[model samples]
Target chain A: MQQIINFFIKNSTKLLFLLLLVISFGLIIQTHTFHQSSFISSANGVTGYVYENVNNFKEYMHLKTENDALVLENAYLKSIAYNNTSVKDSVEIKNLMPAERQEYSIIVAKVIRNTFNTKENYLTIKGGDKQGIQSDMGVINSNGVIGIIEKTSKNYSTVQSILNVKSKINAKIKGSNHFGTLQWDGKNTGYVNLSDIPRLAEIYKGDTIVTGGISKIFPENIPIGVIEKAYTNETSNYFTISVRLFNDMTNLGYIYVIKNKDIEEINQLEAETKDE
Target chain B: MNSVAFSNIARFIALLIAQILIFNNIDLFGFINPFPYILFIILFPTDNNKPIFYLASFTLGIIVDMFENSGGIHAAASLILAFARPSILKFSFGISYQYHNLNIIKKVTKDIFTSLEVFGYITISVVIHHIVLFGLEFFRFNFIWEILLRTILTTVTTLLTCILILYLIKPSKK
Candidate 1:
């Protein structure tokens, strides 16, 4: 026992270092596997508070650009609203019933913390489960898709940004049924890759890509990006296309969280079908 | 607190602010990021309390990791760097490293050779930190070339910045 105490006293520094290193490694493993390791994440209360203040200060610096974007979006929304009112009046004249009910609702939230310099990037927003946000809800800006909600605390949530290496979204070419998986190559922040596209799909350099909506997370036809380059794979018969995202992901501000109302029903029906 | 403890605390806050607010945002060429925060680990007094030093490094690393949203990679790398610091000092400063109190603001500002030795010490330490950080970040053997390229590029950038900051803080002869 004396010798053991002496040994520990002599090499206490090394032992402390080893212990801390192991803890760090454990943290990395936990975050990578479960992705629910929110205790040490930026969404934690203290860290979230610090990031919120910092981002608020930074947001003030970009208010002009943000205001300009808001103005354009407001104009577009007003035009759509005007057209809808006229259509509704004409439908009343013809004694026609209203169209189908809305299937998705949008929750506006502010990005309080964002990181684009890492391999597995995440964004922290100012809304959480308390604000009707849950994991797997789709997040989008006015321009295009941003990411999906990964985890949530009471007053804040973390988003697994589309720039992350683990991000994979279902996307298809606009005006056609050619669908593929959208993934980041960890090369460029502005671009992502669309793989598993059959070689016969008519793809062009400037074609638009939108969400496939095969899953219940997002509604149909949410815009994703534009194809920058398309080429056939050397080892496989599928075409791998490069898409330049419309949303400048690095400079995100206000974003919308999409909640599909029929998601639970759809999932239950799909599970029942699979059981058979 | 004594002047030593006060100055160390000040250094910690200054480095943390610079790392999180300034260096974290500077993504040069889309890949090169100079982490000057490793200077705190590199310049920490060797004869000081080892356990406290290790703890300080771990806390600094974890805070940086939280800000960047990189889960514990920086903490792991910072601990490794701090653990390896004594040997690095011995190698860079030779037997004379044992004689002089080689604190950067005091003894390192005395001569040209001493300043160069300090630069050498920082270069080695920063390179090791960056290699470990990028290696763990891109944890695949297939990305060995990328890891090497990033390590080299970021090492040069960080080393130059450290030397410049050191000079700005304490202008050495030559």
Candidate 2:
């Protein structure tokens, strides 16, 4: 016991210095935005590399479930194709509208690192600038909307998950044309809040919410979530609605990146209008 | 309480207030703020327990960090300064350090060193502390030139302020 005390007394400065240094670093990364981002990106690269290997093994283990999903998607696509051809055959009798060319293209990417526990959660994807993935692009899965791209490195990119506190996307009811800002309250992982909705719009529980397409980042009518609950304050004329998200944000795997080809033109036109 | 402990406690409060309220807010040419609070660590009694010294320095640094909203950069830099204080004293004083083993802390305060030696000691400690503080704050290598320039400019300002304070509060030999 005496020996242990003596040793500690002799080298206490070095030990204390190390301990304090670590604590300081933790505080620095937590409080500062720039430091937080740089630390997260570097940490993302290392952790993403490790997760990729682990995900590969997990993917193999869940092969049967993945196969079933793919089969269902194939069946859905076949039925849509058949319906389109049948409609084309009756176009001569009924005045048919011409189909518009698609303005958005999707690039498939795998999530390597995803976090749902924090107030500001982000996901790391395997595709980056090299794969034409840029900042401000929208990310989605087959089921629903995910988030917008935040930053891209050489071979990896980070997406600001809709679960983040700083996230705000334009969303509206399916048929009512009532729009509001969608945001996460950082309480429940499965639910988000839609605020600034007008009290005059008729909204009910289980009403579908989709992207409002007010911004060029996401296309219109992308499924966001379903209304769980809604209320309006006595003093305020807007309703704050609770929405249950369609995506299980915590268990994400594959996602698609949406690139709008007309985004630049749209932005330029908006800028010109604003200048007037 | 003993005079040494009383003086140290008084100095800690005084320095912390000056650092947080005055020095932290003074931004000369946008980035040349001098940190005079480091004088507490520089003049900390050498005969004191090393662990206590480290803890005090870290606490002082954290308090300054909180006021500045700079996270932990100040705490980390001050801890490093405390750890390197002994070597700095040894290098600057040389044989005089061993000669005054009975009261090494007092000896350093009273010794009439040359201006160059005083300048060198202060320069080394201030430069190193600023480098670590700014390096961790920026945490990026792309702005290497900016970091170097800021470190040099801040070190010179801090060194002057510390040296002036040391001279003003010169320790009288008993």
Candidate DockQ values, in order, are: 0.61, 0.17
lDDT of 2 at B101: 63
Per-residue lDDT over A47-145 for candidate 1, one digit per residue giving the tens place of the 0 to 100 score? 677778788788988899899989999999999999989898767654252345567889999999877876788999999878999889999988889
Q: How much lDDT does candidate 2 score?
A: 0.78
Off by over 4 Å in 1: A1-10, A33-39, A89-101, A263-276, B99-101, B109-114, B171-174
User: What fnat does each of the candidate structures reach?
Assistant: 0.59, 0.45
Residue B137's C-alpha lDDT in candidate 1?
A: 86
Number of the top DockQ candidate: 1
* Clashing residue pairs found in predicted model 1: none
Instruction: Please give the RMSD to the true structure for each candidate, in Å.
Output: 3.3, 18.9
Interface RMSD of 2: 12.1
lDDT of 1 at A101: 55
What are the lDDT scores of the predictions, listed in order?
0.84, 0.78
